[model samples]
Target: MFTSLYTASAGAIAQQQGLDVTANNAANVSTQGFRPDRASFSDLVHTGVRAGEDAPKTGSGEKLAGTETLYVPAGGLRQTGRKLDYALTDGRQFFAVRTADGIRYTRSGSFAASAATNGRFYLTDAQGGLVLDRQGRTIEVTDEHPARAPGAFTFRNLDGLRKTGDNYFAPTALSGAAATAPDAGLRQGYLEDSGVDLADVMADLIQQERAFQLNTRMVQMSDEVAQTVDNLR
Candidate 1:
């Protein structure tokens, strides 16, 4: 009975996390270059002691393992007709930008022009992070249009990249290093829209709500059963 309560509680917590992730994805459905997130779950540890042949498998409960972002290259290009707008053909690739913390990576090509000390205009993200080039230096452009724009980098392993919020990502220990894909570069005058779909996010929200209710029911049922046993005793 106690095990059942624990299982229900764990499941409830996991469902709550799922709801949070779904809500966030829905909120960013229209955000440029926003990636959708999902909550991942796993069954709790199962214990078994061999009695005669095989012991019955008993599990503690379910748990929220982690959350993952779907970085699929699916969003279509949006023609903003602005010179600062940029987009990448590959979703795995990201433009490098310099933030107060350090250099960060982003997929949102919605850039703004910032005047540098020398009077030359430099590219920056909407939030003012300086855009970077292949050499990891701020990209400077004085001409109306350049033959080649700043290079977007591709990661060896995207799993190791950590989201820093504000549509930026930082490399972690798991990601070996950030490098540029020779073939991938920013497409001028275009921005990539957020890949999240409203329909999908809404469906996921309903599923999570039902799961949460189921878990609550389990907890209630287990408590009632325990109360009955005490009365009989």
Candidate 2:
């Protein structure tokens, strides 16, 4: 009876996490270049089942294994007709930017010209991150100094990159090194939309909520059974 309660509680926790992930995705539906996160689960240990024995298996429960950001492009590109707006033509490439936490990669290209103390203007993103050029240097945007195009970088393992909030991603050892994607052309007057589907996220949220309720009910049932046995004693 205690085992059943533990299993139900574990399942409820997993479903709650799933709900959180789905809600986050829904919240970022309108955010530019926002990638959606997915939750994965793994089953726990099983009892009454040997490695080679054909006995019926009783599983403990499941757990949230991890969450992965889906890199697939969503909502397609939108033509803003603004020169500062840009979008990558392909999926394996990201724009490089210099942030306060060092260099990071992003898919958002909404940029503007920010003036420095030296009266020099440089291309910067919405968060004031300086957009880097192909040479990894800040691109100056002035009449005398023509604005250099932003750099496009590709990782050895795109799936290995870790998201660092604000739609920025950082390199991990598993991601290998960043390489210049010379062929990753940009649409100068376009912006990439967020990688979230509202309808799909809503559906997932509903499913997770239902699963959570069922698990909670199981937990309640287990407690009632224990209480009844105690009363009988």
Candidate 3:
């Protein structure tokens, strides 16, 4: 009976974690370049003496395993007529505007040149910071002439891109060095679409909900059984 209780408790904990992950994914469904997280579970250790078992001892209960971030790419390109809108064709990520916090990275290419505050055209992200060029230098557009357009941008290894939230990415040591110059041609009027699959997320949400409910019931049932066993004594 006690083992059953432990098992149910583990189930409840795991289910709760799953619910949280699902909720976050649902909330970010519309977010560009958002990657959904998934929950992982493991069985609990058992404390019992085994009879003639050469292997490790026996265990019967489940455990709430730690969750891992799912980095599966999502969303596609959404063509926007804006000149600065860019999307990576091969999982390359663009550097976000620099902030006091640190340089961040993101796959989101929805960029716009904001008005100059001090004789400088500030290229910023949604949060407004100086965007970085291939030289790891903040791109400052001062020329008012549209003819002097920044042509292309490129990265060394896009797979090492790290998510900094709000559709932002940052380069890691694993990301390798930035390219000497912008090699990838800039597509002036294109925006990256979010890769999230709404149908898949909805299905996962439903599955999580049902699993949580079932786990709750199991815990309750285990409690009742434990109480009944104690009452007989």
Candidate 4:
């Protein structure tokens, strides 16, 4: 009976998390360069159940391991006709940028330029991260050479990159090192839209809600069973 209770509790938690992730995806449907997240689950430890002289079998339980970035292909592109706007038709690459802590990466190509105290024009992202090149140096867009393109990088392990806010990602040891993306095919005067699909997100959300209700029913039934036993005593 206790095992059943634990299983039901775990199921409820897992479904709740799935619903939360779905909600986040819906919220970011219009966010540029956004990737949807999916919940990953694993089975928890089980207990053996014996039936009169029969072989023992285990009951089941579950756990939410973690969330994974779907990292699906790039979405449709919209033409902005702006010099700083760039669109990467390929989803397998990232744009490197310099931050206060270190270099971060993103797929968002929206950029702007600002003049530093030294009177040099530096290209930066919308959030003000200085864009970098394959050599990892701040790209300087001088008046004579103002037409600059961003350097792109590709990861060995996509799962090892952690998403930071503002469409940035930090690579971990597990991700190895980021290398220059091959034939990035970056297009100026365009921007890549977010990869979220509203219809799919809504479908997943509805399924998770139903699963949550079922688990809740199980937990309630388990509690009732326990109360009945106490009453009998």
Please name the candidate that would achieve the greatest TM-score relative to the true structure.
2
Q: After best superposition, candidate 1 residue 75: deviation in angstroms?
A: 1.5
Model 2 lowest lDDT segment of ten = 140-149
Task: Write model 1 residue lDDT over 32-134, tens digit each, in one string.
Answer: 9998887889999987745554678878878889988788865788988888788887888888889999989988988877887888788888888888877
Instruction: Tell me the tens digit of each residue's lDDT in model 4 across 1-233.
Output: 77778889989998888888889999989988888888878888755576555667665667788998977688779999878777788787889999886889998888888778898888888878899876777777765243457887889999999988888899999887899985556888889898998999989988989989999899999999999999999
Residue-pair clash count for candidate 2 = 0
Segments in model 3 whose C-alpha atoms lie over 4 Å from true places: 46-50, 54-74, 142-163, 170-182
Q: Candidate 2 — which residues are off by over 4 angstroms?
A: 49-52, 143-146
Q: Where does candidate 4 clash, by residue pair?
A: none
Better of 1 and 3 by TM-score: 1
lDDT of each: 0.85, 0.87, 0.63, 0.83
TM-score of 1: 0.90
Clashes of each: 0, 0, 9, 0
**Candidate 1 clash total?**
0
Better model by TM-score, 2 or 3? 2
- Model 4 CA lDDT for position 89: 81
lDDT by residue (1-233, candidate 2, tens digit) is 99999999999999898888889899999998888999888998889855657878898888888898888653489999877788887767898999999999998989888898999999899999999987899988875233778888989998799998898999999998889997446778889998898888988888889999999999999999999999999
Q: Higher-TM-score candidate among 3 and 4?
A: 4
Tell me the tens digit of each residue's lDDT in model 3 across 1-233. 67666766777777777778778788887776565666766777765555555646655655557554444453566777766666654344344457656866665666667776576665667778666665556555544222233323335655565656776656678766555345463445666566557787788778877877787787789888878978999
Residue pairs in steric clash, candidate 2? none
